[model samples]
Target chain A: MTEIKFWRGFFSILLVISLLFFIFHVWAVILPFAFGIIIAYLVNPLVDNLAAMGLKRSRVVLILYLILLGAGIMLAMTLIPSLIKEANAAVKELPAYTTAIDDLITKANGEIQKFIKPIFKSKSDVIAIPFAAQKFIDSLIPQLPQKILGVAHAGLWIIIIPFVSFFALSHGKSWIDIIFDSTPSEYVENLLGFMAELNATLGGYVRGLIIESLCVGLLTIAGLWAMGIKGAVLLGVITGLVNFVPFMAPLLGGGLALLTAYFQFKSFSVLVGIALLFIGVRLFDDFVLIPFVVGSSVHLHPVIMVFAILAGVEVAGFIGLVFAIPVAVVIKVFLSVALRHRKERLMFRHEHVYS
Target chain B: MNLSFYRLIKKLFNDENHGEEMSFLRGVPIFFGLSSHQLGRIMQAIQKRKYYAGEILFQEGQIGKAVFIIKTGRVELVKNVPEGGEPRLLGNLGPGQIFGEMALLEHRPRTASARVVEDGEIFLLYTATLEALLKNHPAIGVKLMRNIAVMLSALLRRTNQELENQKKS
Candidate 1:
């Protein structure tokens, strides 16, 4: 009886998760909502920190939102004209990349055809990437209408997010109180302490990840541009964005770039430099970035982290991967604060023990 | 507005859902992606209570009627294990967690005893009340059940992990 109930419960959960994943990924209207969630996560720590300093969280959030608005406008004012000129120049250079693409594809098609198909099905799988690179260039310049639609879509969310975040952050204090108010009088302090720890761990980890990824992307873009790499802007964006996927970004990004560099320069040294560049970025991220950001967030065993990621992936797909660590941290925090045996923190100054 | 703000803001931030601001339970993994209306319903059905230190929440052999949400302070589970192993202090629970859930879910006699370790608060959701709430507001129930499943799955996973770690050691 128990076994049947258990399996039944498990499958139902799996089903709901899959449904939600489909909803988020497939629904265009849901994108704005997803953006809101991302913005909320990004700004929550800022709101919390501000609130700790005696300002009302909502007003602080409002102030920050205004600053973000100003900064975004300022960035566009400075960056847009230059970006447009370069983008136009890049468009003029598109046919050249297309010719390059066709040449590279033709050169590789023979060697690739020999072994790739039996192992991997499509010829397009290996070839389409470089072609897509050309297509991305073509589409960007030619698809003004699509770009306009995208801007409108993204802009709607951009406008809505601050208002939503403001409300959420400002009134967050009240929200927490309601949660406490719902509590049976006896376990309030215990629950509050547990919640505090959970908040810190989850919030800290997420904020750290955002900062690290942005830092990596910004630095890589600057570095690649300095190195005179073609399409440095695009490559940097791709690398930085993909940087979120721990232990996987370098191989994917580097391998692609290595092929590009190998063909472009047709020499060993450029390839070596490119390879070293990727290795350097990976080393920096793994050794310096992740250690600083993700290390102190949670103390889960590696297996647990892997399981949590898998579970999150199963539940929400790609978006879930981003949220998985924080969720896992929350669960861990729950165990320690809400479920662990009482141990006084040495930091508690003079109070011997609350109990 | 200022009067209301002063009265409310003067109080410690407790309920994240009512009065001052909506509870940020929306950020909680359990309540993710739920609409404000949906999240609000769950918050509304809930009720809070307080308990002093050393109170016995429930005991073995007693039929559990309510699930307790630890708002603050600690609740320890004193369990009787007699396989030549020492009796277990299952845990000391702190804020924002729900316990007595298993008992509430199954009409089982309390398998272990729960006692508050300090002056604490809990939100008691009687099964009968929650059922009615579930009937009237099904989304909240669905979300709540999902959240509980997550908690259970986590507990099960941790137990599995501990067993695996023990084996490895």
Candidate 2:
């Protein structure tokens, strides 16, 4: 029996490691399906609501698809053209922006050198920040075409995601039923409890994140357009996408907005205004959007959250970062449930002995 | 109507015996007085599973997490005797009967064990799912809780009456 237990433990560990390894290796291939699953999960509550009203699940899914198709077509006709035009304009002005960036870096480097001159014995000892910045910009310009081409390659995802999500939305319940049916009767209750807890934790968070990002994106676009900033649409979209990563929204979004404002308008006041706008958005997000939308769905400690994000980055780069919080939430819920089950079992044993 | 139109209409509205399921749920004691729509919502949270004869649904003294409603099954409630002989048979339950319902009120040890007497299907409503529903839809929750309270009160009164009779004898 001891040998059997030892082999079981060993195999479990081995299985987990193998699964992780497989995921790491094939993540790029799996990304589109992962996105489909997330979309299905996000849309499930609406489907459930309508289904509870006695609508056929398949018909409801078909109706939802029709609505989404119409919306997508509308967006394609209107938003896509404007976005493309803005992107083309930005690419054309890249050289001018590079020059402006170089000039700014040079000026900043001069001031830094002046400040550090007394500390350093020789001028050569001082770092050339402007040179490094220029080199980095030069390196990035050559990669632009390739990066754009890579994005174009991902057009296949447009077809695959909805196809996968449609089936998932319609059939997700049956899949869950199959799992429940396969589980031993003794553990079925525990499985259900675990699922309930997981849904309670992650469902609200995922849905809230999407809504929050959309609001932020729309707000950013409106604010930038009001200020007559160039590339407002593109920048807003970028800002919204970056908002998924904690603490990145303001840093990357604000920095890009400031640069574009300064280079285009060449005014300190515009840069300051852009900075103030981001701060306002961040405040609004923290106070209103998060509180009302996300509520307290995830209860991970801030420290643990940071560590999970870092580990995610180390494991799978950007995808890892995007999924880190949800993964951490799952782990936390699993541990809590498992520990509770163990505690209950021990307590039951104690009671039985006394009885 | 043309055959294609008839088929389309049928496809659109046919939610496979949903009426039958709702009617069955309406017969449940805890769900008494709930509207058809309310019962439908509750049915969305219920999970149906099949159990074979001789299978244990739950054990005595184990923590309860879900209430089981027999859809088409015979279940027996059994309790362990203090003297450690054969377990005492509490009662047999059939379709529409529910067990482990106290778990919904609180996470506590089940008072008796439930075992499947015949192979059939049962519906499981997890406490967490019910709590979520209660939080989200209070009207349904109010009716369900009130019915549960009434049932418990009747049980208490019956027990009290039995105790009085035994004392008199």
Candidate 3:
């Protein structure tokens, strides 16, 4: 028994480690599937509502798919030339950013040496830091090949996911029925309860999210436009997409935008305006929109939200960040159902008296 | 003679031919002790609504924004469940049964789907009204919870008895 217990414990840990590693390993390939699920979840309520109104779920899914595809095509048609132009422009200007960065680093190093060498009385120490940093960056660049491969895998996955989701949504009812019928009666009820709760949580989340993302995107565009930045739409899309990752997204997007603004405008005032815009966008999200929209429905604390994000990032890099909360919500749904049933059992009554 | 007098009042209140609706509050235990004036206040707040046969009374897992009381006709509780299998019937509910009481304290999602078996009239009580009622009559919340506890416990006991009988058979 002792030996079996040891082995069981060891295997459990191993199983967890393997599962985590596999999730990370296949994340690039799995990202599109996860994205597809999120998309289906976002679109499901609309589709279901429409379906309830005499339209077929399949037809609804088809219509939504078309809208998404048409929108993507339109975006590509509208933005590709400008995007290409920007790409070329960025490539052309890449050297300038690099040069500016290098100059900045060199100037900072010069100041450090001036201040530190005499105080430390060590001539070589001040020179050592830059050389080490530069060497580290050079070493890291070679590892980009795997990351590039991951991006390619992600692209392939994205292309196939929508078609898969359409099929999932259309045939979902029968598939759902089959799943429910296969379970034992009691378990079926539990599972049914779970699905119902899952639907509610995901529905609330997706509805809240789509509205929030659009708000963030539009606000970001307005802010950037007011700040006199070029490519406001593009920056807005980046902001919206990044906002999906919680707190880090807006900052990252804003910082990237700021870098471009600094380079393109070369105006300190423009830089300040850009910074203020990001802060304003974040504040809007934190205060007015979040309270009214997402509100207290999910009831996850900010600290728990942060921890979930970190864990998600650790296990699946970026995709985990997107999925962890809903996944937690599902577990919560299960626990809640189990507890409700348990509560009933605990409060067992021989007689049901009426008021 | 005294029993007959109590019966007369009960018949008068319970009779549909008297041209008055069964005030929904009387069916719910917590509201029994309320003065007629207080019950009248609750009745004024209610939205009397009707549903036809096959019409959804309420969907399972929907956010319970209102409390529903079934005054007449039967309701079948179903769950539109899709796991990965065929969906199963959760249970059935009937007249005088309260469907949305589980979510009285908060907007807990409806656990079971309900649809009218025949044309049915129900009194829809909003959560806001309940909140106000709780404020005005502080004991109502506790009484309401106790009523729910009793209902839930009764369901468990009946199920238990059924299982034991099945085993014996």
Candidate 4:
């Protein structure tokens, strides 16, 4: 019996490692299906509710897709033209903004050298700082076309996502049921408990994130537009997209908005106003949106959360960063459940021996 | 177009006997007072499975995580004897009877082992799923908990009587 258990454990570990290896190797191909599964998971409760009302699952999914398609078209019609115009204007004014930034950097470099002269022995060391900064900016411009092409390629997957999600929503439950049927009855209850816990944690986090991002994005658009900032819609959408990663929204979104405001108006007051708007939005998000919307879905320590985000970026770039917290939550739940089960088994054995 | 759409949907996704299932669930003691709408919500959380005769649903001393409702089967609850004697038969449960219900209230070792006496289908409701349902729909939760409390109180009274009779004899 002990030998059987040992082999079972070993094989289970081997299977899991093989699965992870397969996923890692085919990540690019799996991206769309992964996104579809996520979307299906998020929208499942509504589908289940309607299905419970006697509607067929496939029918419900089809109806939902139609509604979403209609909404998406309406939104695009309203928002796309203004966004394109703003983007075009920004591209046209890029050279002038670059010159202005260069001038500002030179002025700042002079002040920086004056302050650090007493500490540094040579002027060359001080000049190196601004030179490296300029070199970095120059390097990024050349890579813009490649990055844009990558984004466009990813955009093609948007069509495939809904197609994949439709089947997933309709057939996902039966797929789970098949697994349940195959599992030994002894471990079925444990599997059900694990799945239930996972559903609660991941479902709450994903739904809460969408709502929070939407609220933050709308607030940003309103604030920037009120202040007559250029490209308010474009900047707000980017903010919402990057809000998937913690702290990226404010840093990237706010920085871009500040630069735009400075270039467009060239007023210190306008720059300060843009800065204040971002600060206010961040404060609101931390105090109100997070507590009310996200609540306690994720309970990782702040340090661990930051580490997970960094590790995610290191592993899979932006996609990894987006999935980091959910993946961490799954690992935490799996370990806790396995450990608890082991402890219970040991305690049971101990009681039996005593008896 | 509407008729064709309906026909296409019906052809693509065949309808199940949801009405029959809902009526069956409505007869269960815990769900006795629930309306069709509330019962529909519960149906979403419950998992149905078929068991063969002589299959062990769960063993005594194992931690219970889900409550099982016999939809169409005979189940026998047995207790293991400590002195290496034959196991004692606790009771025979039939269709509409629930077992492992204590799991819904708390996570503890099951007091008796449940085995299927006849081939039939059963519905399993995990405690976490029930908790989610209760949290989302408090009205159903209140009704279900009240029925469970009433059933438990009756069981306690019966057990007390049994103990008194044993003492008198």
TM-score, every prediction: 0.52, 0.93, 0.60, 0.91
lDDT of each: 0.65, 0.85, 0.66, 0.84
Alpha-carbon runs more than 4 Å astray in model 3? A1-30, A123-148, A230-234, A299-307, A321-355, B1-169
What CAPRI class is candidate 2? Answer: medium
Predictions in order: chain A TM-score:
0.66, 0.91, 0.78, 0.89
lDDT of 2 by residue, B4-105 (tens): 998898777678768789888888899999987788788889888889899888888778899999999799998887788898888899999988889888
What TM-score quantifies how close candidate 2 is to the native fold? 0.93
Instruction: Give the runs in model 2 whose Cα sits over 4 Å from its true position.
Output: A128-133, A141-149, A352-355, B1-11
Across residues A1-355, which tens digit of lDDT does each residue of candidate 2 receive?
Answer: 9999999999999999999999889987788998898899999888888888778888899999999999999989987887999999898888788777788888888887887878884964457673644477678989889778868757988988999999999998888989988888877887897688667666777788889988898899999999999999999988888787777788888888888898789899888889889999999999999999877556789899899999988977766886787678768887887788788877766453112
Error of 2 at A8 (Å): 3.0
Judging by lDDT, tell me the better candidate of 1 and 2. Answer: 2
lDDT (10s digit) by residue, model 3, range B97-157: 6766665666555666677777876666666556645654676566666766777788889
Select the stronger candidate by TM-score from 1 and 2: 2
Is 1 or 2 the stronger prediction by DockQ?
2
Model 2 per-residue lDDT at B78: 88
Q: Give the clashing pairs for model 4.
A: none
Q: After superposition, how far is residue B122 of candidate 3 from its true place, in Å?
A: 21
lDDT of 1 by residue, A1-355 (tens): 9999999999999999999888857766665555666577667655654453334555567678789889989988865665676567666766776777677776777667666667777743564324445666666777788769877877787777766766666665567677766666444534543454455456556677777877777776676676666656666666766666555457656765665565556789887887778788878887998897655646667788788889878876665675566568667776775443243322222322111
Query: Each model's DockQ?
Result: 0.03, 0.55, 0.03, 0.46
